[model samples]
Target: MSVLSDLLDADWARLCLLSGGGLRPRLWRHVLSPRFAPVLLIRTAQCLHAANWPRLAKLPALVNFVLFGIEVPPRMHIGPGLVLMHTQGTVLGAATIGANVTLYHQVTLGAKDIDFTYTMSMRPIVEDGVVIGSGAKVLGGVTLGQGCVVGANSVVLNDVPVNYVAVGIPAKNLPPEAERSHEPTIDQSITM
Candidate 1:
């Protein structure tokens, strides 16, 4: 199988392990499966810890917790390549997330109200390759355009334009020249 296929298979296997009913064998399978390495195991454990340890504690939930690093309620639909950098404190509401999205720590993607009375009440729809920074909150039926960068600690209450950078309490788009000057460089030694 190709790498993507392998990842998809692993993701499916993980989902089955997490939400499925069987207990002892599932746990054993998760531990003994050669498909899961040490890093994945540790990350899975952390996701379980964050998820308050669901009943049956199936492998799928563990996989979702570890790989995606977002606390996606089982009902939520998420596409593949959901990269979670610093997965801790990320909460995904009941919404469909697209593929290849990168989320940092402390991001929230939830609805404003549980009651369906308001027509405007809805969750955020994250598009592909959209990078959300730490502590950013995208609330209420907003569409994050593709390849947009949400700056750290920004509160995004409006739809962001594609390929733009948003930063502030109520996020505003940065000018093209200013955005160009704000390229972030990473040190390989640091953890994502």
Candidate 2:
């Protein structure tokens, strides 16, 4: 799908999420909210980039970076249903992110090296339905599995399995039983 279409779909998904999946709100409601400014701006940047207008894309991108303090490169691949909850200090630095990914405040998808000489595999890959908690840092070439959850203030330097939760300073994955019983610290709707 086109970037604009993806953005619209994502916006609708978010609206559904916000409405508790009861009623799908009108498009105007999604477009006019100040809370969705960061998302709209980011989606616009992605659209501009995909249209081969990197020079033009940087304009809105810079605006988003400044206004929301979030930096998501237009080149990065993000599927639809992307939700950035509490946009403050959120940085989508990953090489690839799948659909329905929810990110909270102060989340950093960062590189472990200072330069690109380390190879293209140095970037993070976040799969579908992943929820990265606030103040979490996912560094290096780790692949976070689908439905994985990173706890707040955790630092993930390695891969995490599907449907699991990683927590603590260095970030250790919890057992399957533990994950089933534990509820993440964010809205449950985005887990779709």
Candidate 3:
């Protein structure tokens, strides 16, 4: 699909996520929301970079950084339907992030070590329908499985299985029955 199509889908998905599946938000309402503005800029940067306009891509990225304190590289691969509950101080350096991922403020997903050069092996791979809570740090080349949840302020360095919950420092998977206890209150409507 074209970048514009993907961006439009993303915007609609974000609106649905934010509005609790009630009335569809108007274009101006979605565009004017503070929370959605940074996401739009990031998406624009990603599209520009993918189109081989790297120099122009940096403009939106720079604006996002200056306005929201969020640093998202134009090269980062992110699927549509990403909802950042709060944008400030959130740094995303993932190799590939799948669809319907929700991230709260102060969430950091990046290299575990000092690797200035970004590579698949040095970054986190987040699967679809994942929710990362505020102040969480998911480091290294770990894979966060589909539908899994990461608790706030946790440090994850290993892989998490699908539908599981990871909490605490050096996060370990919670028992299947205990998943709901750790998951945040956000209503995740995305499936698959």
State each candidate's clash count: 10, 0, 0
Stretches of candidate 1 exceeding 4 Å from the true structure:
1-70, 115-121, 175-192
Model 2, runs deviating above 4 Å: 18-21, 32-34, 116-119, 178-192
Worst 10 residues of 1 by lDDT: 34-43
Candidate 2 local lDDT, 79-124, one digit each (tens):
8877777778888888899988888899999798764443448889
lDDT of 1 by residue, 1-192 (tens): 244344444443544444464333234455444333322433343344446664433465556566645565544445555545565667767366766666778888877667344233388888876889999988888888888888999988888878888899999987545557654557633644
lDDT of 2 at 88: 82
User: In candidate 3, residue 15 scores what lDDT?
Assistant: 59
Lowest-lDDT window of 10 residues in candidate 3?
183-192
Could you estimate the TM-score for every candidate?
A: 0.58, 0.84, 0.86
**Candidate 3 wrongly placed segments (more than 4 Å):** 21-26, 178-192
The TM-score obtained by model 3 is: 0.86
Which candidate comes out best when scored by lDDT?
3
**Ranking of all predicted structures according to lDDT, beginning with the best and ending with the worst:** 3, 2, 1
In Å, residue 15's CA in model 3 sits off its true spot by 3.4
